[model samples]
Target: MIAVCQFGGSNCDRDAVLALRHLGFEAERVWHADGLPAEADGVVLPGGFSYGDYLRAGAMAARAPILREVCDAAERGVPVLGICNGAQVGTETGLVPGAFTTNASARFRCEHVHLRVENAETPWTAGFEPGEVLTLPIAHGEGRFEIAEDTLADLDDDRVLFRYCNEAGAVTDAANPNGSVDGVAGLLGEHEHTAVLMPHPERATLPDLGGTDGRTILRGFASEAEG
Candidate 1:
């Protein structure tokens, strides 16, 4: 089973579970305090205003008691996928690199944006071809990815899961929705099994709710379940 964690303000936990179940996977919303189940083969930190964005988007949730268990699971090779607010939590918890701060516009962005698959080898992007373009929505005010130039330069290209891009798959500032550094929209941790992205794949998982361009990302859980 896949465990979709629910923080105090995690409105997306149910959406994540529903989307995963739509794809034929067993998913449940495990409350933050309730703890993750031993049967959970995968974990999801879905988008939301966790702790009402206290301190920062995900700072509070990062320090939650259950996060420790999540980290332990990740270290043990369990797959962990973080989205939007969860992406912020992932960075705060050191699951991935870089920081998600205010957008370049300093305002919330909510609309469809294009993304380029940067690393097709990762489980998160294995369904798409290299440089494939996907349309996903962004709804966040603090989605910019801030990283030191030196640190950004050292990031392995293979670890970059996705980058904002034009419809033709060109990485350009014009196509960047949140002004994330290097147009990064998603990134993998040391292992492909761990990753975070600011886009809400759950929102796009339903056939009629939004475009299904994100089903492949969520499908990663099924792969882990089989293992």
Candidate 2:
């Protein structure tokens, strides 16, 4: 079963559960205070303004006691995916690198954007091919990714997972909706089994919603569990 972590302000918990079930996975929303289920095979930090985005997007929730269990599971190689606000929590908890800060536009951006697959080998991206473009929706005011120069260089060598890009798959400033450094949209964690992204993959998983490109992203969990 997959555990969808739900904090006080998380709005995407149900959406995440629905998306995962649609893809043939057993999933349930697990309240933050309830802690992780031992039966959980994977975990997802769905998007939303956890703790009302207090003290920064995810600072409060990152310090939640439940995350300690989440961190332990991650260290044991359990697949963990953090989307949007969840991505912020992941970084705040040191589950992932870099930070999602104020957008370059300094305003909330909510729309469809293209993301180019930078590395297709990781469990989170194995469904895609290098240079493949995916249409995903992003809605956030503080989604810019910031990392140090040396860290950026290391991420380059580690082969970061996703980057904002044009329809033609060109990484350009104009295509960057959040002004993330190097157009980074997603990144793998210290362990490849974990990842975080600012885009709403769960929102894009239903065909009726628009496109199902996001399904591939969620598939990463099942892939890792099976392996």
Top model number, lDDT: 2
Candidate 2 lDDT by residue in tens digits, 10-77:
99999999998899888999999999999887889989999999999999989999899999999998
lDDT of 1 by residue, 77-143 (tens): 8999999999999999989988999999888999989999988987888899998899988889999
Candidate 1 — worst ten consecutive residues by lDDT sum? 218-227
Q: lDDT (CA) for every model shown?
A: 0.89, 0.91
Clashing pairs in 1: none
Off by over 4 Å in 2: none
Window of ten residues with lowest summed lDDT in model 2 = 151-160
